[model samples]
Target: MAMPVSDPGRTRVVVTGLGAVSPLGPDLVSTWEAVQSTRPCVEPIPEAWEAFWKPKSRFWAPLPKEWIQCPLLAPLEPKQLDPVSILALESARQACSGGAPAGRGGVFVGTGSGGGASRFENHLNHLFPQKEFLPGRRGGRFNPFCIAMGMPNSPAAMISIKLSIEGPCRTFSSSCASGTVAIGQAAQAIRSGEVEWAVAGGAEYLVDPDGTQFHGFDVASTLTRIPTREECNRPFDAGRSGFLFAAGGAAMLRLESERSARERGAAILATLDGVAENCDAYSPMAPAPTGERIQQCALEALADAGLLATDVDCINAHGTGTEANDRIEAAMLERVFGRGPKVTTTKALTGHLIGAGGALEAVFCVQGLLDQIVPGMPNLVDPIADLDFVLRTQASEHRNVLKLSFGFGGHNVALVFTKAGTP
Candidate 1:
């Protein structure tokens, strides 16, 4: 039977919990503190990295080797925790710390290049000239687990199984915009009363040798010869080059407004006032230079929140450190904020998390609302536009914020998160 439609006045959505497994840190607190300090997380690829790629890029940010030691992850074998799975599990575990409500709750996660490393490595092992291919080799049928682990939807499936969640489960993959779109879709579901709670976020692990070769061949990664990871990505700087590659995950709990959260006594992190998504349909790999769709998406989100451009206090920019993205994003902000509000790009610190960028940026925006502070952009010495780019230090106060993310295939998403009880 079809479910009943939600009464427009009946349900409201708000953020009740948050989590992250990022280059900056494993959890929200640690990640936020590291971001505030502008600590660079990028590093030289490990020795094993060569097995994955040739003519390699300069730097990438891989999770610390110690993350597998966390008590929450003790259930799984160390080899089982591939980068994508590790990020998904860690972020979901943190987000659901308070426990999702007893009834149906949804799970949505986005990922780009899901588990490509594991699949590629397994393939090469069998295909090499010296190696023999056999049906029963090692774990029979080449271990169906590889496809299961590498599947983009595996993260959401794993999260649902781990948490025993009995409601909707979905995995969205729209190139780089996958994560943000997941959150937006989850919010819509809750607001429309499809579910009581939703776990939403994105994860990625694309720094592997196979992953790098694919991305570098596509000419999407920064090719700088810089020795240090810190100098690899320079978003919005006049001397900006391109985005540094990185891997990470972020997730958040969305509940039906303050009333439901307070009724269940869940901690209210922030309010997700509005969200909007748009597609340019112009190009699959690049955004339109005029940024018309991006501007439209932002305006729609602000309108959904019942606010004007001047009402937003800060912006989490989708600054990918690429020339086309930064310039187009700057134009969009100028069109919407009339010079743009206080803006910062966490990508400067975390690098681009691809499908995970949107959800992580959403978490950052929520943090800006809850902590009343805005994190700064790193390596942005010269301004690219007339906008106020938060730099060097974090902002002292932020009440309302807009988080924007644009991805390949011209996917644009904007989310407006307001302080609790804001009019």
Candidate 2:
């Protein structure tokens, strides 16, 4: 259900801070520059991982190793926490660093699979060894804390604890749309007066050391097996094969009510105009062919923002390179915006982060607005549909943007944003 906006004058939600550990870079500035330049960060999968899984997808956008060494993460014991929690903690640290820590606010994070859960499962498999036990076997060798660490709520809880946020803390796990849904829910909470502010975003690190888990996508034939790293991940291109699975990262934004932001003199990066979420109810892993529900979601988000479709100046599309997704999303965009606004997807550079995709792309939208420059779709040599694709960096006076996210369960979400001063 859409969140109830009780009072239009209650408080407008605005983004004050942003933090990210992405394939493009370790920080926000570097990542934004990479996007604007259409830089390619994909490289051959690390040799360590190749030794085990021999995955079909040879290339992926892996984050820098040094990005995780943040001072805010110093308090936690590294081995005890999963990489998911660590990534979220580091990103939240960046988002909350300089001033805006709403003690009474909430923490909301979206993720598909908890790293700790997968970690626990991997170890459990070894510990149990085919679900058999020797006679007189005493207590298993598995780590006792696995249960607590593996819970989906671990990241949210750790963020709340690290930042001392006392308000409602929640996690959304709606597949790939999880992060966007978490951000939407946080904005709703602010509008509903549930809290004055929130730490909202998504995090995911699905690169398993053993490499056994990612083989599922390979077996399903949903991952690209291109020979060269430079030649893959061409979103919207005619030669596109499939999504390039990669090492996932985390991104977070400090979302606060306008009043709180102004009172604290926080630098407003962008205004979160509105967010809409719905489902296709058509298939578990495929989008509706007619693009009906996706179109409805776009309209609903624009309506919530009190604007018409024409007002959207740009669209940060959910343009995964996969054939079905690209075509369906193109159809949906054509139906919604009529090829009027410029469209681009940063996934060409970031790979498919799955859970963290929406959050990182939303960050790109805000950064683009601040700079008035839209990043182009990297490696897009051919068009699959009738749409205006930004193939190179372009400057614009545009103020409003629509960021769309769709997940495997047909979950759809649209977030409308505007420049800080836009009404």
Candidate 3:
């Protein structure tokens, strides 16, 4: 379908509500608190997982069991649904819980590795007859919902059904940049007058007990074996090795047109002023060495928002704790915003959420705008570059902020945000 024209000033997009289920915590408040305190959310691989796959990276970030006590998720049948879909549903519930006014909106979700984990393992067990690995059902009869639950678009479809969203429900799969792209597209949908609101974000449940799944990254030599949280992942730090795998998580935002929000007296969280996406076309899994395309993405996004780089007070970086990624990202920020806006990466806290990385970082950016404080990087011991790193939580009167996300296959995305009603 052709998108409606996004004529600036005619249809403005604003975020009214936010929700998340992360390794640090289940909901937004807990996640924010954990971020502020620089708490390490990564943990040693669970014993249950140890019985199956022996990941090169022995540490992972899994959601606390207590945080899953969401009333909205109680009705879900875990046997029939994928954990990715469940996480998305719960996050969307919390985001729309504020009773914000909405219209015939839609659901947009971003995920890098979509489903098929447990099902694939079960199928393999049936073929291999393994006693230790995934135990297949006696009849070889998989759950009826396996296909539906594993599709990349499953989360979006589920949210649309549960929320009665009859608009254009869609899913975006751009590797790790999936969630950020979904959010950017959803905001465009509202700005183009296609919907009054959109429930959009990203989620991922890639880590599983299946070695078949973890082996790919393991062989790629990207997996780091930092078993202890204190020693594990450090974003943009000189001592950084690589990102530790993180838990399946989701973050949903209630995005609405400014006109629709005011008409319904919705409490505005922040304005999603602009979004831009581009590709490096350099390599499938590596970023462009020059960092030129990534810089262009940020510049275009700021221009779309009718703002200058100086207007951006803070930036939520896509710091993956890998040597190449941190180096390129640090250089990109230095080139784009100079030694100006405060910079920090949430991966040090939440590990790498993959598809949800951008969306979750966006959550932090919105909250930073509202709270007027920049959250600090947890394990950033020595700066990789001369950029202004937010070493500790500090108060600021920031009005505009930028969220950056990059994915494998050379996808890069940037979103610009401002305090609601910023003139």
Candidate 4:
């Protein structure tokens, strides 16, 4: 048997650098170190998202305030950049720390709630100048950069602007799967010879001053709630309720062709082997109850990676700690991998960064491949399915891994990551 050699563009894509600013920690080292704990780092939110009419979210995991305070980000005046954009810039700066000359490459970022902090909220303040209703001036006009600050593509725009990157700068807003899809899209661009390098990841900031973002998810019944402040986000547990939404954070990866990395003498972190996306198109809210589309998506992803289900050794499950999603995702995993792949979820510690959650999890997956470790599910008590879940942080050699993410409107994505030097 013979195999044809592939060109440089289609040869291989490696993650040369990784950066993340999460509630778990500031940089990748701290984040990985924090996961060694058996419990999550979730914290009680201040004031519990007080709205006069609706319920407020009590649990959240937000990055440290000191990292993004106005004084720290001097010269970037207030209202000129949304929190999501600021977070994106920070993460991208960390990933591109190798100082890749800025003239080339692309920037792709994802944010599910990037627009919530827009002037539209101010317009609401102008109309309803009542206290405890909206958190804004009685009747003040917004700054001129209102639209630019809160645009869905603002994160990507900020990354390019700060890093001086040129090429196809784009953003993915496909709900929760946005970050994973953005990375996939960036890999596609390199495969198609569109660029030699790219910045791909996602950032999310839902903790708007007005509590509107929390109100939206709380009204949708997706924000996870627990009876006690001592416990939170029990993903895959039999009594799981929902995901603990983040106050939000960002994660970024600097990806380049293997050839380019070698030429530049960069260290290879991991490989972006394959990716596949599908739409259940069944329901905007509920996943296909049968888990058929998600099952198909997993198979397609493995196929794209030129590997079978048997080749995958670990799954960074998008286990959001929700009842229905956990059940459906568990069932789909059994159907595809037959409970063989070790399942792990870091959402408890990460607090479901919405769009950025996937990118953060993807970073964890790469780290997992490097250390041969899978993080234990925080607060996981009773099992929902007969799957091999990593109950505590431990070492297990994983050569191939699959990361799954599903968004509202049926946006499903599966990304396959292989060990750095695997053939």
The list of candidate 3 runs beyond 4 A from truth reads 1-8, 47-54, 67-70, 73-76, 100-102, 125-141
Alpha-carbon local distance difference test for all models: 0.74, 0.82, 0.81, 0.80
Residue 289 deviation, candidate 3, in Å? 0.5
How many clashes show up in model 3? 0
Ranking by TM-score: 3, 4, 2, 1
lDDT of 2 by residue, 1-423 (tens): 233332467579999989888888888878888887878688777676555456778777778777666666665466567778878888888888787544479999999886744564547556674554534322344555666667788888889987888889999998888888999999999988888999999988776644554666666666776677787888888888888775778889899999998888889999998789999998988888988888888888887887788888999998888888898888778776777898988888788888889998998888889989888876888888778899887797789999999999899999998999876
User: In model 1, which regions exceed 4 Å deviation?
Assistant: 1-10, 47-56, 69-81, 129-141, 209-218, 221-229
Error of 4 at 143 (Å): 2.1
Q: What TM-score fits each model?
A: 0.89, 0.91, 0.92, 0.92
- List clashing residue pairs in candidate 2: none
Model with the higher lDDT, candidate 1 or 2? 2
Question: For candidate 4, which ten residues in a row score worst on lDDT?
Answer: 1-10
Between candidates 1 and 2, the TM-score winner = 2
Worst 10 residues of 2 by lDDT: 132-141
- lDDT per residue for candidate 3 within 228-284, as digits (tens), equals 667788888888777877877899898999989999998999999879999999998
Mark the regions of model 4 whose C-alpha exceeds 4 Å error after superposition.
1-9, 54-57, 69-74, 101-103, 128-141
Residue 12 CA error for candidate 2 (Å)?
1.0
